[model samples]
Target: MPHTLRLTVTALVGLVVLAVVGAQAVSVEPAATPSTVVRTSETTRLPAPDAPNVVVFLTDDMRKDDLGYLPHVRNLLMKRGMTFTEAQSPHPLCCPARAALLSGQYAQNNGVHHNSGAYGGWESFDPSSTIATWAEDAGYATAIHGKHLNHFDADAPADPGWTNFDILLEPATDFENFTFFDGDSFNDDYVTTRLDERTVADIDTWAGRRPFMIFANHVAPHIWFPESAKGDGDGDRGGRLPPAEAAYAHALKGITPRAFKDPAFNEADMRDKESIVSGRPKLAPRPLKRLNLARIRSLLSVDEAVAHTVAALERAGELEETYIVLTSDNGYALGEHRFTGKDRLSDEILDVPLVIRGPGIPAGTRSARTVSLIDLTATLAQLMSLTPTMTIDGEHFVPTLRDPEAVGLRDTMLIQTGAKDPSARFPGWAYRGVLTQRYSYARRINNGPTAGFLYDRRQDPHELANLLSDERYRAVRRELERRYRVLADCSGTACNRDFGPLPRPRPAR
Candidate 1:
């Protein structure tokens, strides 16, 4: 037995040496500037003959199971490619997640660190040097449709010339009010219908000859939408539910989702409500329900829009060539943790669905590997065989797409936020978590002097249980805490307080 143990240790040591040597041999050279990390090898760069056209369909505030995917959406994806089981939005908000997705950077690295009001907006970014520009430079026509929550500077022109075409479906890119605020909202059916028409026209004109990138964003399953508040007596002017959604919502007959059927609400959520009402002087809670109903009702139209968009691609003979990505900007907090919207760091807000289908990507496979939204930039650039304009926070998920058993892919992900008073000592919170098949460990750093959360995802997927003090998970907690610090350093968001001992989250009484 002793001899066997010695042999095992020797084998492990030899493997470690080999791994170190391999890393040293294959790792790309570091960049001259500290902020940049460039890949120097040709293998790390995009290869020429395999580039494919890209189309990203971004949606707003949609849940994982909201789509008819899995046996349904899964069937569609398989017929057309890749679906990620553990895809995540960088931050659980409209602006920050979108900014990260577009810039291929985290909230801190990108100027738009938080949702609106927290860090001003994305106009602080250089409009000319976005991911769209990089794709455009690579000989792809770029265009955007649907809601534009990433906009910051209202005075700035609607189109920043990033694309050959710009189609604003409404007055503002975001549809928090559900009103079109421009021409007739229904004249072109739903927003999805408009996007479908425009995309089809572009494809027909181009005749599938030129590679193109279209960011077809949709606003559905979000607040102040068609189903959020239907019967509540509020002065909301957002009466813009499409016919299908109106029918579904009408069928609901005042039955809210299982999450919001309760009369009692979370304390924190109520406090937030009071603060918003005091600050903004919005309508009462009853009216808010009506708005929520409206938002919910609008989803059917969006879903149908997705179906039509896919059909349009098929009609254009570009179905196999075009890579379709169905994703949400972020998840919504229907009622979990007493939160009604995104912006707060909760699982419902951060965990988003990412379904992809195209050539070179496998179909009907689901991987549990945690992935970030910004990774889309690198992945798309790789698919097109074009050099990324800048190194991004997102890693290439090509390995996961090609083989479910890819090596060296991440088993953990770090979620950070800069939405804090920079003047404070421990201003922001940083979450470092290791997600295994059954468990997820999320440790909070610098969250209001002392705050953190831990979840046993296997049992409490909703995150109702905060097992920070459950001594049984001591080893797991310690390991996750260490990983958090190491990742924070690697990501360059490491703060002095990040190394501090993590506090156990208190349970709700």
Candidate 2:
């Protein structure tokens, strides 16, 4: 690992609580920063509600490995909840990932592919039988705040079930001006601040009255640093630079894009990645610094947003009874593999941050079990006993949560990108792959440069090396191709495949 990236992982490990019962152990870096520990004070116990209220903080375009930027979330969610280290957004993109979260099905199964245009976007999703409606039917008050799918209109009728729907219509290009369909306009209220306030207000109204589920969707640390941004990142309108509040404009100033220079960053060779990312020019320093720094600065308020949500739940005396989930729709890339955006099936983009606390979950624990956004929604449905109105392609995590040491039911995770659309960031060819605990293999259509590729993820964490063309990998490639075919077009029960223990580990190259 690069020294700086090592520092980040070390710093995060210092903050993570050591655990019991098969918890993953960490060898702390001697120079790791001392943990900035925080503990939320407990409130006086109140009468238990009929069921646990669920609050999900669904952040946008946040990298799975970037949890260190969220101190409050690290201290509160990680320290108090169970962290899923291998959580993934199998189809890593805004519209597809969000659809998976709502429908408990893969992008192919859900019928939502690209971010916008004919085959994708809001028109493709069937929200009529989503978790919102399912939960609402089960007598829970449901609400969602911030960005919905791409191409959804601010004037669009509220999707079926939610009691409160506050959706951001356009890209968060103007944090101070984007309007929520629910009559919210930001004259001066920043995006994160306003979302936090509205969430707190909802907790205040529904905490003691009924079981509730609030999706506090935040556009923090995403792209389009508002034209109104007036601080260090003001000049960054590159679409990759996130908009931070003025107070946080200088935060994380020291951790520039150079800090994340893993071997994959602007890699020297493109022969192996020729299939999709073959000919991109090397990324420049100025843009990398802007993208990295602004991304970090933009998340400071989101950390505060987490703090606010916890405080509100505590004040309502519902903290102990509510299930709090902190996660992201998908992840973004910052110059890794000479790429600057998402929509690729790289580990950097497919992995998503996932942590949960409340009720029966043990504090400071970890689950090594790999799961996807598709699986997460199914798990939520199972937790609430909501009978899905449609077919669910993923399995629930209740068993894994109930027993962290046991192996999970699903063994393979499908990672695919939709065909390029005129409205999206990635104009690459459609690709599909299957990720196991150790290996990553993918194939592309449209006769892209390198038709297929594979990586031994356990050995090549940065994925700088591809093994598909290797003579020794012939057997493994055949097996992976079979699995990929099974999952790429799979639906419902057929989608959850257990391929036994991982294919026998290959010797170190």
Candidate 3:
């Protein structure tokens, strides 16, 4: 089916489903009159006094530096918005990440841990616990356009969420709504442009009705290398521009990050390849056999779409009133550590960009404090003065937007993977790690549990050293092990697993 027509029909189906579901689905009671509730003089600041609109602009499988703003995204956001330098996804996949972001809980709690088709499976979404519900109840016009992981069940249709906008644009790829197949660039039209149009129109049309929240998820820059004949350039689909844009390629060629300039560079450039081929491309060469140009080129459309969305928000007089959060579902690995993409536990694939701009946010502020995407839900709930439905694993980071240097409530960021279902890549590679200011340590869990992929992030940010066996770092290993155990005990992930707590007691000053 043609991408345009398919998305249009899909959008209509979404609307009809939402109308039927929104009326029948249970609704949560709102707080009593505003005057009855006490106002805080100090820290309990709402997200800008004027009920500003909310726009969450999410990308597919984007790396932290894929944006034109590059590493200075924090400062860039600060100038126009706020930035969370340490933002992370609960699990480095699509559906799970989206679910956790929307529900404000970890994969174990939400039950959408892996990609929808994995053995453990997807489709079991908690209807009542979604940000859309809160926003709708708060009298905001909610619209979810791009990807709707919360919209379907077992590849079949389901009410996306109780939002005002019934339009859901599901792609033809497996109906999972999260997976972006490589070499299938032609299929990525709705997310790149169509949704942008829809968002702009929605913002313009509903400018005065009430505050609004639009979730525009774009599927760009995701994996799947096109055939080598296409040449490494952004391929041009039959739209405004063709894929494999040379200008974008040249720009990315200059992106050569300082961190990736080592003598021991891998032959396969970790940077995304832009396919410059005309017409539709084939997908047979596979990873090593195909050219990297297509991947880089693919990202151009996504970047343009982002800029367009930002422009739209600004033109509609909604930018300032809208908390525009630009981020990714998960980070992508161009070619780091011999890995092509995510579904692995690595810093390159796990660390994603988080840019926030809107009312009350300090322009150009950047915080290195560890943060996670799950924090976004809590932050949104707190910002809008809504009660989070359940125990949220993430902390409210709205305070960090204002005071970048402000100390956060949580000391560590926990990543759980490789344990639950054996079907996923790197299965049985259960691991946990912490990114401290000075270093990072990760432990591997196997039949006989032990430390895995331990690294001295300060010296080896590339994650080459497996410092698990070195006697000199025994103390470091023990400390990391203890910390991981403590986090696991408190996290309530999957199960206790009886890994036991740290044997060492806290050091006395």
Candidate 4:
């Protein structure tokens, strides 16, 4: 049998055992109150008669600044919502980031460090301790649609907390038609359109009856039907763009930051960095521009889907009672330092956009606070007035939403890549670091020699220069290393304290 199939069988066996034991021990549990609450200026907000509804739209591999291309998102969400300027994906990989968001734990604690390995992806994740489970136990209807994790298959056992589950089995090549299992049956259709329709229908069905949460995951804007994978005689390989979105080709120009194709693209700086960075293709300007445009065109449907969802909520009379959050699982690297995909400890891949509009959140405000995907779990738990039963590596960022000027809950944010094992999908991608407002630092772990990276964000926002070897920044690098060590293994409240407040946002040039 193939390796993936063998693993799936093993995992199913484990899940059956777990389900049997869990069913026996499970009992009705009372909802718990929020563990911590931060004061805000808006104390007069009305309490909800029931739990507030939550709608999360998570896009895959979307660049932070790409939100400009989606007008509906900008006007409806950003103009009427609060934007977190420094939000990041702590672990910029598909499986690991999703796992962290669901479990509120870092890859080290969650045991899903890489996209595929002995301890990676869905099989290793403990589904019983996810945000969906927490919300379901709190008496809120929960559903998840779209991408779940890399390598998920038919044999994968259903997650216990979700009342409705529709997920893509694996990455698809044909963007126009992809297979999805909608709880009861497997069907092939245009994924983006299907997901949008199902989401609105779900809202129509559950509105005014109960508090519900729906996670609409989009796969667009991710690389689809790459040239390398095309015409291999596989039925999956075909055109990536749907016919409706073809008109958007080259709609917007691609952005080339100062670091794009820099002299240091693949130059040997440190021994450890060379193993992963060297020999990679330098991004060609023309091709990179075209690729970036393709990404934007792919998101047009997602933008339309957002508009439809909000309209559906309004029609259902649930718009005022629902919290809408727009974000991405991870950011993509486009010709930044000779890279075009994620899985590196760089700003290009780590920085993601986060916008939220809800009952108590301020409107038309921008926050410079630094936050991460892991915090989503804690934020949802608090929004529904439920305490988590498991220890998590995230803090409630609801205060930031309530008051954009409020001090950030976390002082330092942890950014990481997956394991470096030879069996791992992306070997030598292992690294962990701490990101502050003004600096980004990383050190290779479990592979290669003691390699370290340090960038002064204020001086080089694009990270064109490496200051790790500069004698002037020696003391700064040492201090960052100390903080990274302290946070690398932290969990729960230990990871919630403020290291230091971020500097004010920089003035536009």
TM values, all candidates: 0.70, 0.85, 0.69, 0.80
Q: Candidate 4 residues 1-509, lDDT tens each?
A: 23453344334433432342221111111112211111111122233466899999999888888776666676568877899888889898878888998889988788887776665667778877788777776766777777786546776666767777767665443455456654332234345767777777778777987788888888777666532345322112243532234434433443443334555443333332335564565556775666666776677667767767776787778888889999998887766666767878888789888989888887889998788898877887789886577999887788888888877566777888876366644443478888887899887775443465778888878776666666677677777877888887888888766766433333435
Root-mean-square deviation of every model: 15.8, 9.2, 14.1, 14.4
Candidate 1 lDDT, 180-261, residue by residue in tens: 2122344323444455455555555444666667777765655333434342211113534323333244532353444453
lDDT (C-alpha) at residue 338 in model 2: 82
- The global Cα lDDT (0 to 1) of model 1 is 0.53
Q: What C-alpha lDDT do the candidate models reach, one value each?
A: 0.53, 0.73, 0.54, 0.69
Choose the strongest candidate by lDDT. Answer: 2
- For candidate 3, write residues 425-490 as lDDT tens digits: 545335556555445666555423343545666666666665566666677678767766676535
Top-TM-score structure, candidate number: 2
- TM-score of candidate 3 relative to the true fold: 0.69
Which sequence of candidate numbers ranks them by lDDT, best first? 2, 4, 3, 1
What lDDT is reached at residue 199 by model 2? 79
Q: Which residue ranges in model 3 land beyond 4 Å of their true spot?
A: 1-49, 69-78, 116-121, 150-157, 160-191, 224-293, 418-429, 489-509
Clashing pairs in 4: none
| CA lDDT, candidate 3, residue 197 | 59
On lDDT, who's better, 2 or 4?
2
lDDT of 2 by residue, 332-403 (tens): 778888887677888788888999988788788999888888888988888777889999988788877767
Candidate 1 segments exceeding 4 Å error: 1-50, 69-75, 78-80, 118-120, 152-161, 165-190, 225-296, 405-408, 420-422, 426-449, 470-475, 492-509
61: Cα error in model 3, Å: 1.3
